[model samples]
Target: MTNVLILGAHGQIARLATSQLLQETDHHLRLFLRQPERLTITDQAREEVVDGDVLDSAALTKAMAGIDVVYANLGNAKIEAQAKSVVAAMTKAGVKRLIWISTLGIYDEVPGAFGQWNHQMLDGGYLETYAAAAKVIEQSGLAYTIIRPAWLSNADTVSYELTQKGEPFKGTEVSRKSIADLVVKLINDPQQHIGESLGVNQPGTDGDKPSFY
Candidate 1:
């Protein structure tokens, strides 16, 4: 079984992916988060929770031992720093594969009025830091697939589509479950979409803003 390291395991999407992985795959998981007590272990046999910050390179490196894939669902204003730490830790630990969760508009790939709306909403700090973070991952020379998901919702559905880096981003929003589903798919076959940044959104969700907004 592959050993998977999930940074920011307390996040909503990470939690969903964790449950799905346990139910569907034989992979062993190392769930790394700052607040370990917040996460409830579903399967102790296949899951191990580590209390650590992604910014702590030593702690991150320690958690990477025997890890086959690193799925980082981390974010915040310090995202750029976190990316650098993850890259450094993974490099030191000899881990190659990474699935990075990012947000849409980091590349300004959204089109039309929606594009303007996205900029208005995210241009200040969120988009800037995330773009910088994605740059760090791309330049790190690791086999990585960066997932740039559209506006997120708590919807229970798992329907979504993808657009490549240069393509105009499609739709307005996608469910957390959909993003989780994509993460599990990549973990199952780490060879797919390596070195690519994908924009994910629900099909037919095209609009000026997310429906919830």
Candidate 2:
């Protein structure tokens, strides 16, 4: 079975992906997070839990050892440093595959007024760091697929669209379950979208802003 390391294991998207992985594949899971007790499932026949910060390379190295794939579902703010740490640890562990969860608008991929709003709202803060993290993964020489999801909701649908890198990012929102569906697809078939940074959104949700915003 493929051994996967999931950093930021307690994050909402990561948690959903974990559930999808558990239900859909027999892959072994290595869950790493700051608070071990926060994760809903601490022990399963095929799961291992490790407690530590994602910015800690030593901890990441230990967590990454013998891992076949790394799923980094980190948050913004310190994401650039976290990306660096994750890449370093993966290199140290000789792990070559990574699935990084980033947001749209970092590459100026978003279009129209939504793009304008996105830039004015996030460019200096989360967008800046998100771009930096994306650069790290692209330069790491690892087989990577960066997923840039639009504003996420806690919806349960699995339907979505993918705007391949270089395409104008379409739509303004996607369900968390859709992101998990795509992530699990990539985990099950790593050869599909290598070196691509994909923008994921629900097919008909394009707008100037997310519905809730």
Candidate 3:
């Protein structure tokens, strides 16, 4: 059975992916949540919870043990540092596959008015940090798939589109469910998108900004 380690286990996308994995597969999981008490999961079944900072190398090493794929569904400003820590731990653990969640502006891939507004809102801040982290993962020599989702929504829908790296990022929003669906797909087929950075969004949702904004 493939063992998967999910960092930032408390994140929305991570939670959704975890739920789907629990329901659809019997693979073993190691969930890393900074606040263990915040995790409401009562069933341990084939999963183990690790409570600590994602930047804690010791803790990360322990979590990565015997894991085949690493899903880093993290957010926050220190994301670059966390990515570095994960890379170091994965190297030590000799794991190859890494699916890291990033955002659209990292590559300035979002075009037109939206891109301008996104940069004005995020550029030098979140985008810079996310891009740095992506650089780390891309240079880590690991089999990695960096997933960059457009403005996220909590909509209870699964429809979405994919734009490979180099393609203009499309759409203004994507559902959290859609993101999790992609996560589940990559987990089931870890080799399907090795070395690819994908942009996911809802078809026809493109505009200057997300509807909620």
Instruction: Give each model a TM-score.
Output: 0.99, 0.97, 0.97
lDDT per residue for candidate 1 within 1-213, as digits (tens), equals 889999999999999999999999899999999979999997999999999999988999999999999999999999999999999999999999999999999998999999999999999899999999999999999999999999999998999999999999999999999999999999999999999999999999998999999
Clash pairs of candidate 1? none
Name the runs in model 2 displaced over 4 angstroms. none
lDDT of 3 by residue, 1-213 (tens): 679999988899999999999888878888888777777775587879898888889988888888999999987889889889989999998999999999997888899999998898887678999999999999999999999999999999999999998899999899999999999999998888899999999999989999999
What TM-score quantifies how close candidate 3 is to the native fold?
A: 0.97
Candidate order (TM-score): 1, 3, 2
RMSD of each: 0.5, 1.1, 1.0
* Global CA lDDT computed for model 1: 0.96
Better of 1 and 3 by TM-score: 1
TM-score of 2: 0.97
User: Who is ahead in lDDT, 1 or 3?
Assistant: 1
Q: What lDDT does model 2 reach?
A: 0.90
By summed lDDT, which 10 consecutive residues of candidate 3 come out lowest?
34-43
Candidate 2 C-alpha lDDT tens digits along 76-121: 6899999999989999889999999999987998999999998988
Clashing pairs for predicted structure model 3, backbone only: none
